[model samples]
Target: MSNIQQLPSRQVSNRGMEGGRRSLCRFLMPLSFPWVLLWVLALGGLVLMPGAVLAEVPNAVPPEGTYEGEHVEQPIEFPHDTHADVNKINCMYCHTYARRSPVAGIPPTSKCMGCHSIIATDKPRIKQLTEYWDKRQPPPWKKVHDVPDFVHFTHEKHLKRFVFDNEGMDVENVAEVCAFCHGEVKKMTVANKVKPLTMGFCRRCHEANDGPFDCWKCHK
Candidate 1:
């Protein structure tokens, strides 16, 4: 009789153990469902996002000083080759005081009239320049090669070092060195940022020249 009673107690304990195991599986099922779902969603996102980004890439660099951004073509196509290359007008002819000032100064209307008044008074560009002058405003010649204002670049220092000759060096003929930073003006029609002026790009050249490799010099 005692053995029979003990057998019923053992069966009850076994049933409780089975019940606990079933409860554990039930608890884990909910947790595992979300974990499996998250992995699937993450993998799907990784596969899809890159194709979308690649499809959105642009052709040319944008204005307002973005290195990799895109731009719509300008309203008026100002061909630099015609004005600077063929005509042999120096860069300082339009952008005067590039050697003296921190700003590569854009010319006022009076400066344009020095040539336009005689060269092509009837041309639309000349007319536009004149109109701006009449209003005491300068043409907003959109800046293509703009470093940010925080970067205090002095044209005076660089020109004094590289351009002005001391004795017989003859200034390295820097007018021909337009391709160094500003790419070939010979081929450009509408102005664009020709170089990627990233930190890595600047460092590579600075390292070559044995120049001061200070981030504060450019980044300020």
Candidate 2:
């Protein structure tokens, strides 16, 4: 009778040990087989490839880097926070033609030197700007917010119509209007594009705002 009882007890212990081994194996199998991870990644990439291709239009560059949560190396480390936030300088102070013209023309070197020539002359960034001013050359500033070549967007129309008249906002004084699409320029050390500025985004905004949806409005 005692031997029979010992046999049942031993069988129960063996079953428990087998169960524990199976649980550990189940946990470790995926990690031990790295090819499983690779196969999953490959399958995901194949699934994602078509959407990635469709997201971008042909001959048009997508908005990315810096303000789009990516970093870009700029020629001059111009801090927008210092100029816009600390100094309380308006956007038109540098981007002069934002109100009157279609293109908010890049500020000439003279505009920068207007203050920088005397102010912070000892600083390296000021020295760099001074060099460019002296040479009469533009500071090779990289274009940040570029629309599709086919799309004809005018700054003056937006400022005059949607921003001031329709939106009941000020001219260039309203940071929120600009920041709606350009991100918070006053907080950035480097200027970057925040909005995708895609046609679909523009169309949605137009539909919401009851603005013109004609092809000629944007597409040239």
Off by over 4 Å in 2: 1-69, 166-168
Candidate 1 TM-score over all chains jointly: 0.59
- Model 2, residue 87: what's the lDDT? 86
Number of clashing residue pairs, candidate 2? 1
- Give Cα distance to truth, residue 52, candidate 1, Å: 36
Candidate 2 lDDT tens digits, 119-200: 9999999888888888899899877877768989888876666455644344445555566557677888887776656655
lDDT tens digits, residues 1-220, model 1? 2352223222322344457768866755765778778767876897788422111111211211123324436535667788876776777667677778877676766887787778877888677767777888866667777776777676665555445632332433344433445655545676666555544444444444444555566665
Error of 2 at 200 (Å): 1.4
Clash list (residue pairs), candidate 1: none
Candidate 2 C-alpha error for residue 191, in Å: 1.0
